[model samples]
Target chain A: MSADAGTDADAGADVGAYADTETGADTDADANTAPDATATAAAAATAPAGTPPDATPWRRLHPLSLLVTAQLLAGAAFGAGVPVGAGLAAHIPFRAAVAWVLAGSALLLAGGLALDVLRLRHTRYRVGAERVELRTGVLFTTRRSLPRDRIRSVDLTAHPLLRLLGLVKVRIGTGDQTAGGESPLQLSPVRRAEGESLRRELLRRAGPAAGGSTEGRLAALVPRWIRYAPLSFLTPLLAMTGWGAVMQVSQWFGAEETVVDLVRDTFSPLPAGWTVLALTLLFLSAGVVGSFGTWAEMWWNYRLEREPDGTLRVRRGLLTTRSISLEEARLRGVDVVEPLGVRLSGAARVDAVATGLSRRDSEENDLSTLLPAAPRAVADEVAARVLRAPVALTRPELAPHPRAALARRLRWSLGAALVPVAVLLLLAAALSVRGLAYAGAATAAVLLPAAALLARDAYRSLGHGLAGPYLVVRSGTLRRSTVALRRDGVVGWTVRQSLFQRRAGLVTLRATTAAGAQAYAAYDVGEAQGLRFAEEAVPELLAPFLVPDDGAVEQPAERTCPDRWSPVRT
Target chain B: MQVVGIDREGRNRGPGPAGLRLRPPHHRVDRRAVAWWRTRLLLAAAVPAGVLAVLGALLGPARFWLLVAGAGVAAAGLAAGLGLPAWYYRVHRWEVTDDAVYVRTGYFWVDSRIAPMSRIQTVDTERGPLQRAFGLAAVTVTTASAKGALRIEALDHEEAAELAEQLALATQKTPGDAT
Candidate 1:
């Protein structure tokens, strides 16, 4: 053991020197913990044939990646250079200027190539028994070391250019939100096979607790699910973008004014109502096509499989392929998110309620999404499968809130509608803009009924109940979410009662959990019922606070008195 | 205090004093909290009052009543500000039990929170310059809840330290498993 520790120290010193060469000043304090040279040598020995025989455990990146990165940079610069060079040539001697531009482009590409080579040389990664370490930089070195035990995810991504060369970038992360970008050890442009094996080896845990061997295909891309893609909130957004693109394309062709004139001429021959309807149809159709194309690009070969190594892997994308593996142990439960339009079509998307999937990383959000918009039943089944449970937890019939909650929502909605009307009235009074009174009246007329309907929908959406180990809560109007959260995952409870809510005998019980949005609320429930629900959901956590409603002597609360829980000062 | 002593024995005795209001047995912080609040509130009010006084002076003798009105408002403001802190001091109370730390505070819209010992991630004590001068300290308890850290302010320095130690000891025993 002492000899092993001595060899480890020697390898550590070597790593420290290599790290110091790039950083040039600050010492890597944890250098003593660098993986042993013998182990790193063993890794290099097994690595592909052309690896240098040097004992420095610093392994360089795939050599072709440098050329690929340089070519990509040079191609982008060439595109940007052409127009400017052409414009400058009109001012100077065309031949000389063209020659100078060519020379400049060559220098730019050469500089980029040289920098990439240095960066590759400086970059080194070692997968030790306990942790994964990555050291990289040309000038400002960043050394990251993530513990193997804390490694929650390993994702492989290959953009079109890199994919053509059969290379992939590996992102090994601890799934810590506060660690930010520093937490992920990025090994850019490694050989595809090497990346895959590294992902597998690093994520492999040893325990019967790891349910690895029961591998099964949970869900695969259903081409029919593409039909639901257009029936989403993104459809309208894409439609707006389509309209923008039409104008932008015309502008690019230097015929924007002519196109606008042509559009006007076509519409002028029709009634205003017909013209509006025609334009709406045009945009909607364009949006439908756009959404279809986007869906194909995003989910073309999407496959969700439970791997033999206890990882829930999601592989998808057409042009730029992605393979993300999430440890099943980290997954708490699942959320079935249904936007208003999607919900109307009997579809919902399933999202994993897991730790380390912070919203800060857009990629994590994509990886956390277990299923795209699909039939409600399919989404529920996928959620159930992911949880390894027999029945769909979120599919339980939820206990609805009282009518007073609905009344409160309606009043709130009406008040919100009135604010807009009041704003329009003020605008009309101040500016005396044409048709101002009509606009104010129209706003009120439209918003009042819409708000009322939304309020009613919101009331209908409110519910909370227990489903085995899961505490299921459903709520929202425009975008309803039904979350089946693992009961043990809940860390604390927050009971809030505003003066108005208290007066109405309502209380909001918030279940504070580490996974999925941090806190989920059972909103505007009857105070007694809410307390009872909270107690039953957690058991013993809140049971001591309740007193029996019988006509008997009052028993004081077990821990904190009821008087202490009161929100009123007096 | 006497009522609390009687309540334990009266609890099982037929009907147990009907219509009697039950007050929490939570202990209030150091009385110096009133002074702390008064200074803080006065400091906050100074800028607006100064601006009003300046405006009154700028209006000149043609509207000398403006100066009188501004002075009256500033005086009223000061009086209310001073009185409000004292009222806040009276209401703000906290208690630390074996299982949880309970706090009741706020003047008009009072808020109460109970952070269970098992859920507490950290407990820290802070003493501002003014607080240091007054020999007062504040203890902040952080839980995994979205409401953020709960603070018990303006306790005597030594008492705050002792309370923090006790809370930390209780929290350590639970080994908070929030994440």
Candidate 2:
């Protein structure tokens, strides 16, 4: 691997200063390298701006990380049964076997460390004033750069192992979602402070003006907020996880029957109904405690603050902390999410409707969650502040869809419930299973009411209206969301009417935007009313289709089609 | 029990808006689109019908009536395939103005859309294997919209290309004011 950044002379000169710092080869050296790395950074900082682009010295990850990687690889090798398999094949004696295993592991660790050192030597990154560039790979080299101006987010994350080593990974992204490969610049296992500086440097937008009181703290971590955490759907999930863990561990001990017998014995004295009720209560309590612990671990020192550099930053976590920075300028609006149980407690969470947060795979998408579960009023207050509006649009009562929408929901839900009933009836007829008949009756009795209730809730959730510069749309029963989207942010409108919707005189109007999930819908609204709403939301976009609305017409059927869809008569 | 409104020339209209009747869409696709759709639809239906006919015949005399029904379905499918495309062609119309693209399509459940030019992300021409054989192509216009991309199909290859270029120009004129 070339230590020489020789191909680019100016960049090469900058890279030379880091050679001394990168050679911290021992574990003790690893602990001491934090100050040395910072000193090297300071010494190299004297390079002039005229040097080809914003090239700072090329630096590698901290040396301690190499040890961590080596340890992990050695563990993985053992887990793969490599050492045992090889030892057994060699027919090694008992005492010699232990030595052989130790020697083999030591050799594996040495090889892994040596390769990691080579990897570190080959990997070089420079944080330029305008761009952050990374060049890596020994066999297949890759040189990638991301413009600082395009940098959307800078996130810091540390898992348990890295946290133990006082190291964290820094991920810098350009906010472009469609890039297929490993496009983001990742600086793995940097000293905790180094990670902070990298985040500060990359996110520093222009120089912070002296004597400016631009910083505003939106919300700080409060212990009481943890109370709302247990109310989330995670509670039930965590309870199930606990039960599954108990079952799994017992099976591992080959005493699964004993565990099951113990559980059955505990509940044997109770009536059937009381048993179910008691079990449910037990699970709920367990779930509440479990979710609360998880919440604390995730958000121990939670803080949402606005930096002077036009960024909304969230810093939190107890064991493995994270600092996620979202550029304020890219923020479109906010969505106040209220899940059913949380809503009952009058609590909600605030999510930013910003560009570049559409990552579907990881919890990194939660980077835009400005506020954790809190009081509905507080969530609204924070949302309003984030969007810089007078008040949150979601607070307002949304205009309801027509009655036909409710009927449609009922029909759909009932149809879904009927499928199981139909199947159970068919099964009963074929096998003369009398129990199936009772089960079918029970299913219908329970499902029909539940479906009807959900349908009603769904109907109640549908609404859309404008709140200042924001267009507010609320929908969904299971995961009810009220989004305050910037009117200017909306790029277009898509009006759809299925055959059923048309017959019911309803249209689902969608406002397409680049922010959030790209579209927000006002489902099953009165057709003309929806059109007028769309026209009002963005006049330039939907005006031509309005048909003037003047009081004069020869044909009524043509009026129903709207100007855009009405067939042109020659 | 009845409501009447006076029209412009003093004619009484019953329980409806006195004005605002829209003019019917005038434009249609390329003439060859009808033939293209007919051939595709016929093949799609014919294959399924042939499979069903074979399956029914294999079931022997006890299910001889099923074979007859399968043959009857095949004939009906063939008839629909030959005629439905022409009817669909009459309903399928698209018109582009300075501001938006209006598409009226679908035979059973007619759907129409007015996609604004300002929101268009990219416009491209697509030629599937079969479309290429017919010397026809489809113009797809996409926005960041969740409805996915909208395709204007069965146009001459050159015409589709031209339409895509025009749409692209429109998008450039109204570039997204976002990151």
Candidate 3:
């Protein structure tokens, strides 16, 4: 019976040519019942007449995709039903409301399934000799193709349901950003084996093996690294989110007032200050747990490996596993990022400064992260290995900005810290509110010292220097980033001087590049020193625009040469 | 040749010494840019002022304050519209060398940019409606780096087109994917 079914499916391929006609619905129903059969049929029908039987043929996403889509829809339906059901129950019988929600969900599920069936039947992809192409859509069929050579990344991801069914979603990208932020090609829920083979086949380089002997695991998950989770900036945010969730849930049950009153009564006996501190501690502990869980989910089984062909692959995640591959040829440098909280705990993360890493991915998911928050030494070691530098590039002492830069930071920080206090005091005076005056003083007491400390840290963080083949720049107190960028990768320079900076003889020099943040700045360096640094960092690039002191003096008679023009006195 | 010497500290030291400094670019934008900027500024300011005046007449309680706000906005706009365009024309300068394009722009805050010809990816000429009316156009030279695009605003239309074409030719001669 199995053999008969297989042969019948192949035979159906010959008839499948007519499936695109008005009778597409009838063929689609067959696809819904026996998706594997239809998938094989589609492959056979799409194969060209003269091609060999075993030649690369069209393929369809796994049939279990329908189940995945159904599960997602069911989740959405459930979330929507609760609120809608409540509204209906308030106006009608509770039993009738429940019946209405069930009926709506059934209709929604049926409609979604029908659309997905059509999609499954129509969507077909083929890996040709020089290109990968996908043809899909029911009403307006679209064909998208990516050149095999230009293919930059082939990432595979699988959520719990897809993993259970031995399926994975394949995202093929040229890393060429299109107007709309969507992956160029997505083949969701392909067989795990097929997805793995596709990844290997697509990324297989043509030339001699690069990093051949060094091909092995570069880094793997260290169980102790989980200790850094609660130290992340996410902890405070998570605490706030937890509080919001509690409030929302209580409100939904119409017990918000009771919950608030209960909390008030519990804390009423204690001093207000103590109550605030205790509540904060309670929320923070909950946040610590939440962050730990999130960290585990994100970094579980994390492994960084260099493939034989020099492709760097990162495989991680617990419930939704992800495998991201990057070509070594595209890598420009790396960024050692230390958020304030993480830095305080002596840890940092490493992110790849590679070309074609999409801005959205980096912003949303930290997709370029090569290492999670780890020991500072570990981060430096990983960075050295990744960049193949003999010495750790980020370990060098950098040339600090002048004291004027520190003064500028202090001015800005103190000014910002004072604004709220000033506003509060003014309001107190105008409204004659004695409590407002005290509140203003309290705010000043907490903020003034903190602002000064941050300003000093920020000043200390501002540094730039050349290390071997890279230009290292460091800045920021809240989230300090020390980026070691390839000197060759720098495409241009932007030097800015505001009125204040001009008087202070300081300039902010920004090195513009195609990779990473696109620009890294050396803030508030001495004017001549910054220019000299830019010149030294990339020889001949800035030489034509600069005039040395002696050159300017000697060429004073050259009227047409702007290079002889004197410095603009403020 | 005439020399106006200034020291590193920005003191007018009367040609006593010379110090290393960035020279201003050679070419200034078209004089008509001043008029164009004034018109643009006035148009931008007029909307809010008109809205405030209308609201002052329509509303009863806030009429005096609204009218006063409208007058203040108009006065500030008038002063800026008259003074800023000329200052911008003085500050905005651009020069293209065989190896790179250099530009200096902005009045209150000065910005200078240099993009090497080898790194340039695209060169484009744009003429907005108002600029076209004044026979002016702007040239934008783009490098692979997002922040490295150089714009030379308010040039003679023909000159802008020629500059863009020249830049495109220069970029074509240089190889490597500009990244």
RMSD of each: 8.4, 9.2, 7.7
* Tens-digit lDDT string for candidate 2 (A1-570): 235555456446444433332332222432211111222334444534333433366677877888689769877767544536444545766667666666877887888888888777767787866456676667665555565766777889887778888899998877665343434678887889988888888777733632244548888877888888887877899999999988866664466899989978999999999999999999999999898888888888899988766778898888878888888766778888888878878888898887656456235546778889889888988888877777766788777777888999999999999999989988998999999988999999999999999999999999888888888899888778899988877766666667898667677888877677777889887666666677777776655555533434423232223233222333
> How much is the lDDT of residue A419 in candidate 3?
100
Clashing pairs in 3: none
Better of 1 and 2 by TM-score: 1
Give candidate 2 misplaced runs (Cα > 4 Å).
A1-55, A70-114, A206-215, A246-282, A361-365, A421-442, A548-570, B1-26, B45-91, B105-111, B146-148, B175-179
**Model 2 interface Cα RMSD in Å:** 8.6
Query: If both were scored by lDDT, which would come out higher, candidate 2 or candidate 3?
Result: 3
- Among these predictions, the greatest lDDT belongs to 3
lDDT of 1 at A9: 66
Among incorrect, acceptable, medium and high, the docking class of model 1 is incorrect
Per-prediction TM-score: 0.80, 0.79, 0.86
What DockQ score does model 3 reach against the true complex?
0.36
Which pairs clash (backbone N, Cα, C closer than 3 Å) in model 2? A54-A128, A552-B19, A553-B18, A553-B19, A566-B24, A566-B25, A567-B24, A567-B25, A568-B24, A568-B25
Model 1 bad stretches (over 4 Å): A1-13, A16-56, A82-107, A178-182, A212-215, A242-274, A362-364, A422-442, A546-570, B1-25, B51-93, B104-112, B144-148, B175-177
* Ten residues in sequence with the least summed lDDT for candidate 3 chain A: A30-39
> First chain of model 1: TM-score?
0.82
